[model samples]
Target: MSPRNTRPTTPRSGTRQSPRVALTPRAAELVRRLRAEHGPLMFHQSGGCCDGSSPMCYPYGEFRTGASDVLLAELGVDGVAEPVGFWMSADQFERWCHTHLTVDVVPGRGSGFSLEAPEGVRFLVRSRLLTDDETRRLGPGGPSHGDASADTSAHSRSGGPGRA
Candidate 1:
């Protein structure tokens, strides 16, 4: 018998509210290890230029976020004191706002700047269209650091309520 590297960390059983972003179990395990080595961490997906399309992880506050960036989620991993913040460029978010992202670990050398690069594994994003319920729960503009309010209006499974 072989040991498994992945496990379910978030409730995907359709009972709990779904997050805009989540981590695969393997990714979560790696996050714990990285946290041990680097204190706290944050992730940013630039979606273009030097970063290419891979998500980059760094020690918290190492990367300077500006008004053009949006926080997509704060992912929780067991044994870690603070949640890992995941941010995306605002333009990228606007294009991908309809999808739910899952951060997964893959074997490859990604951006040299990402902390995990030296570990021989990289973080990547997997996505699926947000379920109708999830879209409404997350509200129209996606998650903001201070926003607690969500719009629960009825929107069809075909698409969210006009992306407004």
Candidate 2:
């Protein structure tokens, strides 16, 4: 006989939190422009240097936030009754919200958010760095995705203004 699927079919229980991020008119406009250009955006909190918490936005790909195994204490976010679309730590999610950005999950690539920027340039933030190949995929006017190596190399050699 075929083995029965053991995964829990029941949907997790929890209240849906309203997206309460706030943005200036300029920022909102920027978000709109980016949405019009790119298909969707993603948001995430990752383990980084210092306190080990940093927020990142992505243009594509699937990412998990607020998973069952994640510890609420570590994330530093509160008032969450259930795991949302992603497996973000409570604290990190709070920080993203504090930035006044709204997160959305798309059907194909992944989940992300749109932010309005005062500057005319629309920016894309991602949890992971973009590979050189991925940057090429962006066609034109997209932010750099790969390592800081590419960005820092020129500055190191130039010893420009900020350098000693």
Q: For residues 19-122, could you state the per-residue lDDT of candidate 2 as single tens digits?
A: 22222333334434444554343334454553244334433223332221121111101222111212234444444322223332222222123232223243
Indicate the residue-level lDDT of 38 in model 1.
88
Write candidate 1's Cα lDDT for 1-164 as tens digits. Answer: 10011122456422111357777777888888998998778788868898668889987766666556666666667787665767777788889988888889999998989999999999998889989877666654454431123211111122332112
Model 1 clash pairs are none
What TM-score does each of the candidates earn? Answer: 0.76, 0.29
The regions of model 2 sitting more than 4 angstroms off are 1-19, 45-55, 60-62, 66-88, 91-164
